[model samples]
Target chain A: MARLNVNPTRMELLNLKTRTKSAKRGHKLLKDKQDGLMKTFMEIVKEAKSLRKEVEEKLSKAFKNFMQASSMMTPEVLESALLYPSAKVELEVKTKNVMSVYIPYFNLKQEGDILNYGYLQTSGELDISLSAFQELFPSLIKLAEIEKQAERLAAELETTRRRVNALEHKLIPDLEDTLKFITMKLDEAERATKVGTMRVKAMIEAAEAAEAAEAAAAV
Target chain B: MKNNYSIAIVGNKETILGFKALGLKTFNANTTEETVKILFELKKQEIVVDEKTGETKPEYAIIFVTEDLAMGISKDDYKKLSQQALPAIVPVPGSKGATNYGIRRIGQIVEQAVGSDIFKE
Candidate 1:
C-alpha cells in the first residue's frame, strides 16, 4: 500500500516493470540460497550435538579422575609431576567455505607421551587422569571446530533470512504497486486524448454547418 | 610460519599462570576491556599463506578463556567472538573451581545443533 513518489509516465512504467521482473528473479535466487544454507546448517548442527555430548562426558570423567588423583597425592609431588609436560601439540588450522561462510578445519600433530610423572610418586589414578586428558585433546579441538562452524552458519542464516524477507515482503511488493500505478495513469491519459480529438471534430463540423446556413440566407 | 598452532589462556594472573608451565602462552587480563582486547588481538593475527598452494591458515587455533573472566564481558561481545570461526573461544574453569559455564556452553551448542534442549541438566 506504500506509494512511491514517481511521475506516472510510459518510460517510468517500462522501467518499473523490468525492475519488478529482476526483483522477482533475485528473490527466488536468495530464497534458494537461504534453503541451501539452512540444509548445511542443520547437518553441521546435528554433528555438533553428538560431538558435544561426547566431549562433555569425557571431559567430566577426566576432571573427576584428576580430582581423585589430586586427593591421593601430596601437593609438592603433584606440582612437580605436572610441572614439565611431555606432550607437544602443533595445530594446523585452515578454513573451508560452507556456502559463503568460512568454517575452520583443525588438525593436530602431537609429539611425545603425556605421562611425565614418575610411577613411584604418583598414584595410578593420576596416570589414568593424565591419559584421559591426553585422549580428550583432539576431541576438544573437534568440538571447537563443530561449535564454531555452527555459530558461523547461524549468523549467516540470520542475515540471509533478513534479506529474503525484505525482498519478499517489502521491495518486490513496492515495485509491483508502482508499476500498476504507472500503467493506470498511462491508460487514463490515452483515453483523455481520444475524447479530446472527438470533441474537436464535432466543433469543426458544427462551424461548417453554420457557415453553410448563413451563405444560403445571403443567396 | 612455525607450522604449529599457538594456544593461549586468558584469565586472572593466578589462574592463567599455571598454563605457562605446560608450554602454552598465557594472557592475564583482569578487566572485561582487557579480555576483549586480547581476544581481538589474537583474532587479528596475520594469516599465513602457503607458497605453493596459496592456502591461508590462522596463527592461533584455540584460545581458552576462564569462565569467570569470560562472564565479565558483555553478552553481545561474547556472542560475536563465539561466532567467529578462527580462534575458537572456549570457556574453561579458573583456579577458584569449576562453574557450570563450560558445561552449559556445550549444552547450548547441543541445543543449537539439535534444535531443542535435549540435555536434562
Candidate 2:
C-alpha cells in the first residue's frame, strides 16, 4: 500500500490518526458481520441443497408420468384437456431480515380442485401425474424461497468480507505510514530550531566577552 | 413483503401441462423470442409500492421456467431476469429429461458468492 500523499504537518498527522482509528473500528464490526452472515449462509445452503434434491426427485417422477400419459392420448385431446385449468394458485411473499439480507418466505395458496377437467377426456396416468404435481407444488415454492435466500445471504457475506479485508490490510497500513512520516518531520524541524538558537547564543556571548576586555584595556 | 403474488411457469406444451394441472398459471413459449417476451411480461406484472421504504417491487414471487427455454433466452435478457430480487427465476427440466441445470445453477450461485468452488470436492 502507498502512503497517503499528504503534507508532513502535525495537523495532517492528527487527521491520519483519526482515520486509522475509525478504520480499525470499521474493520472489527465488519468482521463480526461477516461471521454472522457466513454462519447463516452455510445453514441456508445446506437446507436448500436437501430441498432441491427432494424437489428434483419428485419432479422427475411426475414428469415420467406426464410423458407416459402424453403417449397414451392424441395430441389434440391432450392439448384440449390441460389448456384451460379451472383452478388457480397464488403466492404470498414475506421476508425476514437475517444479517441485513431480506430472505424471502413464500406461502402458497391454492383455490379450487386441480382436477377440474372431466375424466373422460384424460387418462388414468394423467390423473396420477397431476396429483403428484399437486403434492409437489408447495415444496417447489419452498425450494425457490430458500434457494433465493441462500443466494442473497452469500452475496452479502462476500461484500462484507471484501470490506473487512480492505480495512485490515490496505487502508490501515497506508494511514500508519502517513502518520509516521508527519511525526518524524515535526521532530526534525524542532531539533533544527533548537540547535540554531544555541549556536547563535554561544557566538554572541564570546563577542560580548571580547568587547568588555577591550574596554578594560583602553581604560 | 407483499401479498397475492402470483406463481407461474413457462415452457412448451408437453412440459407446462403438468404444472397447469397443478393450478399454477402457465405460459407456453415455442420460440426463444416468445419465451423472452413472456418472461418480460411476467417481470412487469403487479407492481407494489412498499409503504415503509417507498420502493416499488413486482408481485411475482416465483416464476419457474423450463431449462430448455431459459437456456435459449438471450444473454442480456437472462441477466435482467437474474438481477430481479422479486420473482425468483427457477429452471426445471422439460419433457425431454433432466439436464441437471437446475442443480448446477444453485452451485453456480454459491460459487459466485464465495468467489471459489467450495463444492469442488
Candidate 3:
C-alpha cells in the first residue's frame, strides 16, 4: 500500500511521529468509549427486557380487568364509563448533551406528577384498573427512553469500533512498514558508497606500488 | 475512560457458555471454592469488585446470573455488589423459558391496535 509522505524532513518526521502517537492515543480512547457505550447498551437491553416483561404483564392484567368490567356491566354503560376523554397533552421537546451526544427529552406539563382526571369518578374495579394502567405509564415511557438511547449508542459504538479497528489493524501497520522500508533503503545506499570508496583507494595503492617497483628496478 | 472494569461469570458449564458467546469473560466454577477463587482473581485485577469488598461485584456495567445461583448468594453479597453502582444484576431466562411477559404484552397491544406484530420475527 502507498504510505502517506509522512517524513519529508527530520522536523516533518518528528511531527508525523507525534501525530502517529496522537492518533494511537485517540484510537485507544475511542475504543474505550466504544466499549463503555456497549456496556451501557447491554445494561439497557437487559433492563428493557425485564421492564418490557413487567409492563406487558401489568397491561395484560389491566386489559383482562377491563374485559371483565365490560362484560359485567351493559355494553353501552361500560362504553360511556370507560371512555377516556383525550387530554390535550402538549410536550415540549428539548435536547440535552450526554457524553457529547444530543438526546431528546419530553418536557410534559406535569413533569413528574400524575394527572388523574377522567377515570377518577368511575366504578371501584374500573378505577383500580385505570390506576394500574397509570402506574405502568411511567415505565412504558422509560422503556421508550431506554430503547431509543440504546439504539443511538449502539450506532455510535459501531462507528467508533470501525474507526479504531482501521487505525489499529491497517493505518498504523502500513505507516510503520513504509518507515522501515525507507530506512533500510537509505542504509543500503550508504553502505554501497563506502564499499566503492574503499575499492578506489585499493586501486590507487596497487598502482603506486607497481610504479615504485619499476623505479627501483631502473636504479 | 477512568477505570477498566470487566464482567466475569462463575457458574455451571452451560450458563457461562452462553454468556461467552455474548462477548463476556466467563469463569466456569463447578464448586463453591472455585467460584470464590475466580471471584478473588477478578477482584485483584480491579475488574469485579470495588477494591473494598472481596465478593464478586457487578463490573462490566452488567452481570447476568441464573436464578438458582442468585438465590444461593447472600443478601450482604448483593449489598456489597450494589455499592459499585455498576451494571445491574439481571436474571436471564434459561433454556425452555417462555417469551418475556412484559415484551409480549406490549407487543400484543401494539399488534392489536396496528393490526401487525411490532416484535414479530
Q: Each candidate: what lDDT?
A: 0.74, 0.82, 0.51
Better of 1 and 3 by DockQ: 1
The true-versus-predicted C-alpha distance at residue A171 of model 2, in Å, is 1.7
Error of 1 at B90 (Å): 2.7
Each candidate: how many clashes?
Answer: 0, 0, 5
By TM-score, the better pick of 1 and 3 is 1
Report the lDDT tens digits of candidate 1 across residue range A192-218.
999999999999999999999999999
DockQ, candidate 2, comes to 0.65
Off by over 4 Å in 2: A212-219, B31-33, B48-57, B72-76
**Between candidates 1 and 3, the lDDT winner:** 1
Report how far off residue A183 is in candidate 2 (Å): 1.1
Which digits, one per residue and each the tens of the lDDT, describe model 3 over residues A57-128? 665565566555445556555444433323222233344554555543433232222222344444466555
Tens digit of lDDT per residue, candidate 2, span A44-137? 7878878887888888888998899888999888878887887788887788988777888888888877777778977988888888889988
Task: For each candidate, give its TM-score against the true structure.
Answer: 0.81, 0.90, 0.53
lDDT by residue (tens digit), candidate 1, B43-84:
777565776876776667788887788777787887766665
lDDT of 2: 0.82
lDDT of 3 at B4: 35
